[model samples]
Each structure stands twice: as C-alpha cells, then as structure tokens.
Target chain A: MISTKELSRRGFLNMGAAAGAGLVLSQTGLIRPAHAAAPLAPVKAEEALIAFGHTGPTSDEGWTWAHDQGMKAVEAAFPGIKTTYVESIPYSADATRIFRQFVSQGANMVFATSNYGDFLYDVAKRAPKVGFYECDGRNPLDNLGTYYVQHWYPTYVAGIAAGAMSPTGKLGYVASFPVPSVYSGTNAFLMGARTVNPNATLQCISINSWFDPQAATQAGTALLDNGCDVLFGIMDEAGYLQVAQDRGKKAVMWNTDLRRYGPDAYISSIVVNFNDFYVKQVGRRLEGSWTPTYELLPMGGGVDRDAWGATVPAEVAAKADAVRTKMMTEGYSPFVGEIKDAKGNIKVAKGQTMTEQELYHWNWSIEGVSGLDG
Target chain B: MSTWRLQRLPAASPLVSLSARLISVVLALVTAGIILAATGKNPLDLGAQVISSTFGSSFGMADLALLFTPLLYTGLAVAVGLRIGVWNIGAEGQFNLGAFAAAGVALFLPGPPALILPLMAVMGMAAGALWILIPTLARAYADVSELITTLLMNFVAALLVTYVATGPWLDPSGMALATTARLPVEVPAVWDIVHWGLPVGLILAVLLAVAFGFTRWGYEVRIGGSNPGNARYAGMPVRRHLITVMLVSGAIAGLGGMMEVAGTVHRLQGGISNNFGYIGIMVAVLARAAPLGVIFTALLMAVILNGGIILQPQGLTTQTVLAVTGLILFYAAIGDEFARYRLIRNAKPAGTR
Candidate 1:
C-alpha cells in the first residue's frame, strides 16, 4: 500500500498534497505550451529502451490502475521497449534514490506517478540523458515532462448525468483536498448539475485526503446526512460509491468504471484514457522532439465517458455523450462567461470562457458548490 | 489438563544458543520465500537484488549512509530508552518536534553554521525532550502507562507538526504542499557532501555506545531498566532515572530529525520520515537494546530496507518489502526468545534428533 494515501486512513496526513503542480505552473505561466504541436518520430524501435514506472499501486484498481494500463499499452505497442515498475513509492528522498537506481540500471525513460513529486526535478535535472515524466505532477524542469489527465472534461459530462438524474437536485461531492485540480473538477461537476437543473447544488466535503476508505465512508455519510442524493468522489477508491449503493442513491464514477464496486448506485464515470498521450510522449522522446509541457488531456485523447448501470437512464447518457462529442469536435468548455464563485462573485464575465491561467490558479469554488468554506 | 508442557532448561552452551538463533533466521527466510513463491514472485536471489541495488556501488554505499544516519540516532535513542525502562514510544513525535524546532531556528533565528548549527541541535533536542516532558512526567509521578501516554503524545506531535507545516512555518513557495521553509544552516559533511550529516551520526553513535558501556550513569540505568523494583530497593533514584532516560531518548531521537533536515533534505516536508522512529524499534529489539549493538543493527536494518527497494521493479510491492522485513524481525524476536528460555520437552521422544 502507498503510505502517502493509505496512511490517511489512520488520519495522520490531513493535507492531501496536490503534487508538484505548485512548483512552477503559475510561476512560469504556461499551462499549455504551443511547442507541443511539433511531432517527432520513434528512433528507439531498433534498440531496447527500458521504461521504468514509479507509482502507488497498479493493484490499487483506481488512478494507479489506469496509469498501469497505459504503461502496459505502451509496452505492448512498442516491441523493443522493456517495462519495469516500482509500486507504492512515497514522494521523498527514497524516491530520488529509486530514480537514481532506475537510471543506473539502464532505464532510458522514467515515469513517476505522484502529484507530490517536485523532487523528481532534482533527479531529472541531474540525469539529462534520461526522459522523466511526472504523471499528474506539475510542469517543472525542462528534463521533466508532466502529463496529467484532464478527467475534468469527463467530470463535466458526469455532472450532466448527475444533474439530470438527481431527483432531489442535491448532489454530494466527497473530494480529497481543496487543490485547484479537484476544485476545478468539482466546479465542472456543479456546472454540469446546473446544465440540467438550474437549482441543483453540489454539497462538497473535503476529507483532506486522497485514499482513506473509512474517511471516504464518513464523508459520504455526512453528505448524505445533509440531504445530498448523488455523490461524486475523486482519488483512487470509490468507497463512497459503495456507500451510495447501500444508501440506494446514485453517485458519479471517477477515473475508472467502478460501477462494479457499487453497481446498484452506478452513474456513468469519467474514465481516464492515457494510452494515446503515453504513446505520443514516448514517440516524441525517441525521435528527440520531446519538450516540457503542461496541458489538460487533449480532448478525448486522455479522458472518456463510460457507461453506468441501468440506474442511469439512456437519456442522461445521451446528453453526456452529446457534451462529450461537442467537447471532442467543437471544443466546448463549460467555463463560459456568467460563471460565479461560491460567494456569488462574478469570476468569468459573459462571452468569456475561463483561460488555462484562471484554471491553473483556481482558488474559489464555483457557484452551486456548498460546504467547502471550512 | 494438556499431556505436554514447556520446560526451561539451564543456560545452554554458547554454540547451542548461536545455532538456535541461526536456525531461526534460516527458518524465517524459508517461510518468507515460500510465501513469495506462492504469490507468483521469484524468491531466487531476492536478497542479492536488494544488496546489489542498495550497496552495489560507491554512490550506493554513500546513499546507504545517508539513509541510515537517522536510523542510527533513532536506534540509539530507543536502545538507550529501553535500557532505562523509559519505553519512549514517542520517538516519532520527538523526531518531528525536533524537525520543526530546527526549522524554527533556521527560519526565525538565523546565524552562521558555527552559531546556528549548535543552536539548532540544542533547540531541536530541547523541543524533542519537551515533547516527551508531559508524558514522562505523568509516567514518573502519576504512575500512568508510558506506552499509552507516549503513543498519545505522538499523535499530538504529528498534528502539531502538520499544523505548523501547513500553517505558520509552511514554505510560501511550496505550491500548496505540507512543507516547512528551508534551513540556512545545515550539518556539514566530512569526506563527501553526498553523505551530508552521516559522519556526525556515526561519531555520535559510537561515542554514546562507549559511554553507555563505561559511564556510571549508564550502569545505573541498566540496573534501573532491568529491574526497577531492585533499583528502588537499592536506594537508587528511580524517578530521576525515569525522567533522565525519557528526556535523553527524546533528545537523541530529535537529533535523528535534525540529521534529515540538515544533512539530506535541507527542508522539512511531509515525507520527511518514512517511519524512521518505528523502524528504530526493530533495530533496538534486534540489538537487544545495547547502544553499541544499536549501531550495527540499525545499519543492518537500513541495508535490508534500502536493498529491498530494488526488489520493487522485480514485482515486489511495498507490502512484499515489509513482509521481508517482518520475517527478519520475527526471526530476530525468536532468537531473543530462545536466548531467554531454552526449550525442553516435558517427555522426550525415544529417538530425538
């Protein structure tokens, strides 16, 4: 078990650290670099290049599982590449040692999948020859490339489903930390909730952790206790979804189709698809055109909409599909003008969509999200 | 009533005792190997992989020193505490308090290394000692359980550090993560800066071990811990011993925290410790609470742990690494058990091997 997440179960770490994002994005002011358009060819096809993975656990069956699948896909797609992974590595000095060992062992590419990975820059900057990717980490050094999932797009779509289906018009959001990423995702969910029902409000509870099954359960109960009918949970496990199932309520799925965990309370999930993004990065590195980047999942390239059980009606799924299509084809963003913060302060004016700058520095909870002022 | 019962024989020969310990260790390894094999992991050369990865090269060796320096401090602290019957379970908290204390000095009270380094050590150790002050006082005066009180104080320390880390002492530039500001004055290196504060750790460990062996207070502490009632009956100041041991244990463990901050990390972060305090318990147990033995045991534990990280790429999970450590610890405990009590059958079979 990854102590960073699992130790939260014991209630020691209340500050669910939001990875290396705090290292440079706002300081550098490049959420999306224009240099990403340049493509490179695969040069390592003839020779073996070892790809090393450092993450929490592939056996996690959640966020880490999704990344593991992407790694497997990359390994399978490239016939000449060999893959090695060290699971449940905490983001610390040991992490630096682990990375150095990977390099010494002849690993050409390394992917560290922890948000709390600013130290990866220390390791990557020193090892100039090796390509370092921080999975879901902030965009940091030139040697290190940060590839994060824009499950927010899919989260918006899930919000749409939750908006239409919540009979009480009160949705619950059990989130881990009040970071910009989670804040943005929950705001997107609230935006989706309002898309179908203008009066719908999301009651969000931050357990200040990422993976505490017990905390998730307690927060889920609190949200339900406060009259929230549909729940949306972030982080690796969906223990809250299981609570939703037991309570006979619907909750939106996250990162994976965890409907199996709580099939009875299933709502379509915002599945994370990183295969396309991973392949693109490795291809870029091989052909020597890799540039440091920080961008949301390229539309549908890194995130997708998944089917929930029969609990989610076909009409809700169709609406979610329509939004997903518009986002993929027409580049639709829910961060349009007329958006307001929790305090009814105008954040984005009419005819103005939120910029990546605003998104990166996201501080305020959007309108229709309650209970996070604490 | 059961037909059979355990009987303790007189002290066995040293060779017999040594063989029993070795046999227990071999048994633990075999058991671990079987479990790993059952779980679809290759048990072949597992230990080799760990060793080669952690202590394989010159750099690896230096890194090993860097990792184990804290273990040495914590190990010695626990060893010393156990020997005095203090049972300072708040080593983890003391370590954290020490880190915060060092950070406080570096951030708020700055000076050159000559002035600040010693100040940091004193403040850190004082903070650690203060962290155990209440619990130790309770244990000494009210006859409260040290184990529970110290354990409870650990939580207080964790929360206190987290509060300061995320609130007042937080690094303004740390991108919304739990970390304290950087320290200006850090412990310097001896030969290579790579090992950071490791040489100091070694010097401290050896000196303390020697003192524990030679000093009059050390002798008294041994007597106090081994038999507190006997110590009191002998007109020894048991209360004073309790307070002294608890404070010293906290102070040494606090040094472990400072080592990480001044030697390696340079800043206190959320991941400052991966249970260095808890692991020191294993080291103390393995060393039989002898300060000299603590140095070797902590080094051995650190090697096993650092080496085990290499096995992760070989399909070993953190749990797997922990299982290996646990098996070794189990073997060590069994060795201690056998050393304490010689096994004798109530009725020996006719053809005993």
Candidate 2:
C-alpha cells in the first residue's frame, strides 16, 4: 500500500499539471466547458434585463443615439423589463470586464451596440450560457451574432429628393470611411439620383472619420466650390449641410433628423430606428428561437426615408414619398440588374440583385461618382 | 492706487497644503452634488451608489486594480518628464508604439512563454523610445516646440495603429473593425483582474520616487531642465540627461501599453490609445510631479473611472467621471495656487510708503 504522504504528493502534482493545461487552453480559446458558465434558464421578460451600448447614450449624434433609443424601446415594449446600459463604453480591454460583470449579474442577453465582434466572441465563448448581439460586427460565434441596418436604400430615396431639388447637375456626398457601408450608401445615392436626373454626377470624398465637424465642413466647402448644389453625407452630425445653408444649396442628412441644425438646407435623411430590431431580438431570446444570424435588415425593415425638409419642394417630396412607398410595397432591391462598376465591369448582372453577403464586402464604387481617392 | 496681487510664499507647508487639498476635494464633491441635483439625482444616494459599485464588491475592486495598472504607469511617465522640466505630451503615441511592438514580437516570435513575455517587454520599451526619438531631438536641439511636436505625433501614432491593426498585422479571422491576434502566452493575474502588472506599476512608481530622491542622475536632470546653462557650465551632459528623461518617460508609458496588450486585452488595437497619456498628464499635474503623489492620483482616477462604468445603469456614465475629474482638477489647481501664493492688497505707492 502507498504511504499517505506519497499519494497526496502525486495528487497535488496531477492537479497542478491539469490547471496549467487549463490555463494554456483558455488563452488559446480552446478550453471549453472547464470554466464556462453553467447552462442558464432563459429569464422572463418581466425580470430586469441589461444592455451595453458602446459610445454612451447622449453623444450628440452618431450610432450612440440609435443604440440608446434601442435600450429605451426594449424597456418600453416590455413594461416589466427593467433595462440598463453602460454608456460611452470603449471598444477596448475594458469591454470584457464590463461584459463579465453584466453576465455575473444575471443579464440574460447583453447587447454590444458597437463593432466589437472580437470582444463579444471571446466573452461569449467563455461565458457560453450568455447570449450576445453586436451591431455592425462580423464575428459569428455560437452564442454571438451581429446586425446592421441597410440604410443605403433610404439614402437612395433621400438622393431622389436631392436630385429633384438640385439646380446644378453636380451633387456632394461626404463619406465617413471607405468601408463597405459607405460604398453601399454612396452607390445607392448615385443610383437614385441618376433615376431622377439622368445627367446627375456625384463628388464624393471620405474624411476617414465619423465625428470631425471642421473636416466635414471643409469637405462640404470643397464640394460646393466644385459646383455641387445639393449636399448629403454620412457623419455624426449634419455639419456638411451648414455649407448648403450658407450657400443656398439643397442638402440631406444622415442618421438623424437635423432640420433644426440646418434649417435652410435640410431636405431629407436616412433615419434608422434600431428600437424595432432590439425589441425583436429581446422577444426572440425570450421565445428561445434565437440563433446566430449575421443579419442586415433593409430600409422597410427598420430604416425610414424621412424626406420632408423645406428645401425640398412640396412636389419633389410627394414624388420621393410615392417612389419610397412603391419600392417598399414591391420589395424593390437596392442593387438592380446590370449594375456596373466604375470600370464598366458587371457588379450585379442582369436579372440578379445583390445579396447581403455581396453588399457587406463591397469594394468597388459604381460609375457617375468621383474616384474614392485611391 | 489700490491693487490686489498675488505674492509668492517663502515655502509650501506640507501640512497646510494637505489641508487645503482636502478642502478642495470636499468643495469639488459638493459642486458635483449640485450638478447631480440639477440632473435630478439625490446626491447622497448617488454617492452611495458610486461607492458601493466600485468599492463594495470584490469584482469591482479587481476592475479598479486593472485600470490602476495602466493609469499608474502613465502617471509616472508624465511625472518623470515633469521632474526633468520636459513636458511630454506624446505618452499616448509612445504607448501606441509599445503596444504595436509588443504585439509584433508576440506575433512573429513563438518561443517559450517565459522568454517571449520578457522579450516583448524589452522590445516594447525600445519601440516606445524609438517613437520619442524624433520629437526629443526636435525639442532638445532644433529649437522646435516639444508640446506641438509631441501632440502632433499622437495623430501620426493613431494613423500607424490604424494601418497596422487593419492591414498587415490584422487577425485574418477578425471582422471589419480589426485587431491583431491575441498573444499565446498568458501572464499571471492578480485576483483575475490582470497580471502582476499592477504591482509592477506600483514598484516602478516607488523606484522612480527613490531615484529622484537619492540619485545623482536625478540631480543632474533637475538642473539640466531648469538651468540648462548652469548644467552645461558645470560640465554636466545636459543633452544626454535630457535624452534619458525622454527615454525613461516614453518607456514607462510604453510599458503601460505592453501590460494592457499582454495581460488585459492580449491584442494590439487602434482603440488602445484612449487618451491615457493625456490622463497621465492630469495625474502628474495634480500630484505636483511627485512620484508618490502620482500613485495616489492614478489610483483615485482609476476608482472614479471604473466606478463610473458600473454606475452608468443608474445614470452615472463615464462622462460623470470626466465632469468630476474636471471639477477636482480645477479645485486642486486653485488650492495649490493658494498654497504657493498669498493674495494681498498692494502697498501704497513707493513715495507714500
């Protein structure tokens, strides 16, 4: 028979070895089930819920307002649900700590309202029982999914309003970054403009930022100097429209209603209500029907074509509204047949519409727009 | 002629200054309370909420510890520069370079964890010093302004981070908002918050205080910064000492970047540069460029920031920290002024006196 001391030593060595292996595995994201959260029962909607939004609730304009409203809507939809959120949450190391805190607090579904796919993926893998939904991220973990509104189609409607109101054939489109989202938006705007004004051309430039008011205004000035009489762009605010207001040019806004900021220049905007999506997400989780979905909801699904600015005349607004309704009723695809890239290369061939997958990785801009400054 | 003027005090009384600072802290809290009331919150309840969220729980303490790890290093970095009469506004850029270099080494070199981690640390510090080389020379000999160059380099550093994080070093499997892959080696954690990074930062701060207190290098650096002509006339290598000051300052801040990447996030990201260098400046300024004071200020700032996050659900967002910190810094500035200078009615004209 083995001595008690010897047996205990052997046992201690084995435990140490196992713990070391566990640490290695966890670091590589290969450790499964060893330290994961236990399988948790879905909490009822009546229970208090938690949601985390990156870039706090009231950061003027940007994705912040949209996500903040989503959390508010979640609580409003389910009267018994008490929703809470940490605002101005950065996309950094602090993410996982805060996420774990929420999970530890019995938060059934945590909403990462930013493009923090990697962070969510890591946390969701470790905390397997908790569900995560990130906005605009592309990580497709087992318990993690992402959602982004296809605001391009509504911007197309806004472009139609711009086309109708423009006296000069040139239009300005300011882009935040050269991501696929901007590609989709600028293309749709040009397509809508060409549909209304066949000779319309776009002068588009990306400032490589989302919230630089001075740079945005400078881009607007460059467009105006180059003869663009109708300005529209993607930015945290309607800063570009200030140029339009100053120079008697028609303009459109992105992300929010900003006629108050640019009263004289405002024409229309692509206002996406993320509240609808968040409610659906919460409801789905409650029903246990939630699955990993890299979803890209379209204009009719969540975005609205709010094209009622004084700069856009009554008849033009009516026409834009009619076109919007028709497109929604007929489920019109944003990328129609025979869509041509700048090189006249076929992007969307005849009798085919662009899929969400195709749009998400869009690289080339269409014809009738300025160079992407490559 | 009646005039109110500020007269420089002979010497600062540490005890009186401490009392003044305490009074200023209380005043800041009261002002914060007024702001809270204006926003429709009960000041006492909110105060209770903040304390309970940050200090009441073990996990919250761990989070505070994690935040303190970076803050302490950054604060020391700024304080080191301030002691040498060099105002470094480029700790943020240096921090980015450190993270990039650490991640680079981790990505390219696959050695034993023990060897690789230390190599990453050394490489990180070297990279940070490299980042400051141009700005340091420009400030030291070229008669260029260090403040402008250091601040501008931060933008360049941001661009570099974006390029590296999104292009060559990007994790192949990652999404659009890309980041580098996680380091394979795991650094030991302190209560599961982060690694021994907190202790390392504290040790660095303590060592800095000692070095400044007892070392000849510290004495040389002080004279070189304040009276460069005197330092040169005394045959001291003022330029060399200035380089050391900048290098040490950059290295400390850079170490912070390495700690976050290797221990906390385990990745190189553009978001890593979140004005930590700027916050470090605040810490150094609030602490009057004293290393021990930096430790206290950094820990205090960390509590407010980390605590602010947990309280966001109760309407105390990160902006609450910004507001409270701004108020505290403002009051502390006034308090320090009063400690160093006395306001007196100007004496009658020379003829009359």
Candidate 3:
C-alpha cells in the first residue's frame, strides 16, 4: 500500500520515461511516418468553402449532434465544396478570434452557431469578405445573416397535449433567462393550455442557464411542489425531462426532438429542425447567391409536420400528427382570431394572421401569464 | 606564453545555461509526442501543423500578438505574487474588474483629448488594485490564505459583469443579448497600432524584469520570499511588502484587462477572458518567475492557443491540443524541479561494516 503522493510521483516519473521512449522511437523512425508516398489531389479552387463554428462539441449528443448530421448531409450532396468547422469554441473572445482566423484562412462562408449576437455582429463587421450566419436573434447586415426556428407554434401545440393529458389542470414551465424566445414559447404554451382547460395555470421559473441539469431539476422539483402535474421547458435540454421522469410527471421538450434524451418521460416535443435551413443556406452559398437577411425557417419550410413532430404514446403521437396536419394542410394559424396581450389588450382579431412585420415587432406576452420582471 | 595554460571543459558545458534549456525543450517535445500518440494522432504532422499555423502568415502573426498581449500582463501578475511568497490566484477577477471599470469610464465620460485615455487606464489600474486589497489585507492581518479568497472572487466578478451587461450597462439597441453599449470611437487603438497592446505589454514586462534584476526593492523582496522569518528578523516589514506585491500584481492584471477592452472588444461582454488568469500561473511557473522569461513563455502559450484554433479545421480536436499543452506543462514543471534541486547519489549507511 503505497501512499497516494508517492504513487503520484512514481506515476509522473513513469509518464516522463514513457514520453522519452516515444520521442526516441519517433526520431529513430520506428513509428509510422506522417506523409504517404503520394499527395492528395487538389480540390477545385473556385468551389466555395463553408466553415461553421459550434459552441458545443460534436460528440455532445445534443445540439451540435443534429447540426453535424445536417453538415454531413450537405457534404455528401456537394462533393467539390469544402466544409470545415471548429467545435466547442466558447462563445466569447475565443469565438471572435476563431472567426477572424477562419476569414484570414480564406473561408468564403462562416456560420457561428451561438446566441452571442453582438459578438457575432462585431466579428462580421471586421471580416466583411466572409459571409456570416448566426443562429440567434435578428441582426442582419450586408455580410451577416440571422435565423431562428418558429418554435412558438409547436410549443403551444405541445402545451395543448400536456394540458389535455394531465389529470390535474396544474402545469409547470421551466424557462431559461427570460429571453424573448423563451418568453414567447412559454406564453404561447400557457395560452394553448388555457384554451383547453380554462382554469389551468402554469407555474414558471427562470433558471438563468441554458444547460445546467442540476438547476433545471431543482426548478422542476420546485414546480412539482407547487402542485403542477405536467412539466415542460423551453430549454431544449434533457434535464427537465429527466426530472419529470423521476417525479412521474408528463413533459414536453424544446428545440430538439428529444424522445431519445428522455425516452421514459418525454410525452412529445416541439422540435426545431435547424437542418432544413442549414442545408438550404449551405446550398445557397454554394450557388453563389448568399444574402444577408433574417431567414425564419418556420414549420412549413421545406420539411413539414411529419419531419418535426414526435411523441411517446401512440395516441399522443397521433394527436400531435393531427395538429401538425391541420397547421400544414389546412393552413391553421395558431395566432389567428381574438388574442389578448398579457395586459388585456386585444392583440389579434378574428380571421387575422400575423404578418412577418408583426412577428418581427412582437414584444408583448400573451394573456394569463404572470411573474414577468423583464 | 608560458602562463597560457587552458583547462579542459566537459563536451557539454554545464555552466552554459542554454544547454539545459535546450534539454528542457526536447523533453517537452517528447512529452507532447507521447500525448499525441496516446490520443492516436501523428506527432510529426501535429508538430508541423502547429508550427505552420502559428508562424506561416501575417494573419498568424497578428493572431499570435493578440493572444499574447493580455497573457504578458497576467504572467507578470503571477510572477509578482510568486516573488512575494503569496499565490494570487484571483488575477482573473482583478482583470475583469479592471475591464469593467474601464468600460464604465469609456461609456460615461465624454472624451477630452489624448490625456483622457491614459486617465481611464489609470482608473482601470486603481479598480484592479482595489479589488485585490480585501484578499491582501485578509492574508496580511487575519492569516487567511489569499489563494482561496482570490479564486472565489473570480466567480463573484464574473456574475457581477453578467448582471451589469444585462441590466444598467446593457446596450439598449442590442436586442436581448447580454452586453454593454459600445465605447465611443474616441477610445480607439492608439495611432492605429498593430496588435494594439502587445508592444506596450512587452515593454512593461521587460522594464519590470530589468528593475527586478537590479533594484534594491527586488533584492529585499527576494530575500523576504526565500526566508520570511529571517527577513522579519532582519527588520524588513514582511507583511507590508506582501500587501504591496499583491497590489502591484493586481494592478498589472487590471491594466491587461483594460487594454483588452479598450483595444479589442470596445465594449464589456461576459466572456472577456478565456482563463488567461489561470494560464498566467502556468506562464509564470514555466518562466521560473523571471519577468523576461515570462514574456517568452507567454508568447509560446499564445502560439499554441491561437494555432490550436487554426488546427481545429484540419481534423485536430481542441482536446488533443490541450492534452499536448498539459504534457508540455508537466515536463516543464519537472524540468524546473530538476534544474533547482541536485539529485544526489546514495550515501554509505552508518553501520555498513
């Protein structure tokens, strides 16, 4: 039984010896050589290269996973075009530094996949030659593009299902940071729940982090203690679903189709298909018509209801499918007809659909929501 | 002619310090090689790629300079603390506070002429120095370890910056994101300088190195650090010196933060630092707490970090690069220990008959 400190020192010495051996082996040509006999054939010089920056690692099993799948698809589709990426560049000056380096390396197109909009904007301005895309709020410039999924509709639909399934009309919503996107989805979900069960009220809490499982679980437990039978979140992570499973409460997911993330607890999810837009944008860039404008990849963009919606039980899945069909085929607008703001002002009239302009200017929460300090 | 007798020197001159340094470099590379092999990468190619990406172009040079600028100050900060026998692990917090103060000054005060910029820089230094005062005083008076206090302060400083950017300091027109309003154009980089702060940071580090090498204060601090009891017995104000050293360290780190904000970011953002303070410890350690050596170590670190980003697109994982860096640091630490302590062979046992 060697002491831990002595063992650690021994380990360090062994490591040093091993490293020395490895260096000697390499220098003596005992290891395999780096270069092959022949060089790789040159790629077409005119073909555009798209470089994407991801905040999460490719092996994260979540957001970056889906984005990588889409990137792989694009790569397969376009043979001559080059696609490169830097993963897990933290959304800070490091991200900016990486973006600038990419531009300097002659990246014709660059995509920064994070919500640090101002940082993205600054980098975009500095590297005007490189086409930039940000997967966050709108900050469209001459060389920069912003895009977001229309999550409000799917979230509202998922809320309706949660409201219908829950024996108790009490629902819980765990939100992140009270951002407009999160707030919009939460408010819409509550509105949909109210539509089904008029007496139902949602207990909401903001945890101020996007991916902290412990905090999310704590928020979920707090919500359950407040007597909410069903839980949902706009966080798009597995934390809430796991908490729901632990507590045997129903839950809906945000951003991702998260059946795999929480197979036992996830009843359904409001999935965001970022791939459809990402592939399209990559294609557009390859075609040499890259525009700098806000692109909203709504539910009906390219891939429709069948591609995005998912649920646990067969019946719930059917209902989700039906709702998706109605929205896609029957042209059902979720916000159509007689909507009120949180302050009781009528926001939309009967037979009225919100225009793109109205959606862009949407800042008010829906009716029957409380605890908005923003 | 008769008096010109020459003594035979060893084939490798032990007195020539460059040989020892060269051995250390080779050992570092070997350690990196083992790491690369363990991670299933070709060491030769990785080494070539790192070199090419760091020094292949003007862009690489610019990137390297940008990366090194703040690290120079941070390295100096850590070196100062190491010299005074106090481990100041909270330079990151001090740096952040300095940046925050600089941003506040730039955003609020309407610019005069050239003098105002230096004034804001002074304010940044003051903010940084004041930030460390609590830990410094606590360590001096209450015997509380500055290490824990300083490290904990980093979290507080980070949270405070987050609150400021999202609340009162938020840019109104900058939708939903947590960031301060951009500083006015008046605080742009001085005279279109290349890598705006790197030259200044390098000059400061060099000046400090020279001062430390030749000055009486430096000699006293060295003596105090090596033997605190003896230093106090010799009538040196050890406690006061500790406080002074910590304050100076914090001020240097704070100035680095200010330069970053004013020169690069031009606004206060949450992710201003990517663990530069922590990296500062490594730089100082690798440099053996020598100011001039700190500059070179900082430059090497910058090359690795900046080149790591470039290598990422070439099928290299950041984890692999980081693993190599860790290996390098491990070897460097061991090398330093070997350099400092002579490993004596075994002595005869007293009762060996």
Using TM-score as the measure, name the better of candidate 1 and candidate 3. 1
Against the true structure, candidate 2 reaches a TM-score of 0.80
Which portions of model 1 show Cα errors greater than 4 Å?
A1-43, A52-54, A167-169, A195-209, A313-326, A336-352, A361-374, B1-27, B34-44, B104-116, B159-171, B174-186, B189-196, B341-353
What is each predicted model's overall lDDT from 0 to 1?
0.72, 0.75, 0.70
Best by DockQ: 2
Q: Compared with the true structure, what per-residue lDDT tens digits does model 2 show for residues B281-333? A: 88888787889999988988887677666656676766676888888889988
Per-residue accuracy of model 1 over A1-374 as CA lDDT, tens digit each: 22222321222111222221122222122454433333323357545465556444677677778888878888887776777787767746777777777877777678876665545666787777777777655435555666665666778888888889888899988876555667777888888888898899888777645666789899999999999999987857778888999999988867788888888888877788777777777777777777656656654667776765677788878888898889878777777777777888765666655554455445557778876543
DockQ of 1: 0.33
- Give the winner by TM-score: 1
True contacts kept of 3: 0.34
List chain A TM-scores, every candidate, in order.
0.83, 0.80, 0.77
- The lDDT leader among the candidates is 2
Question: In terms of docking quality, how is candidate 2 classified?
Answer: acceptable
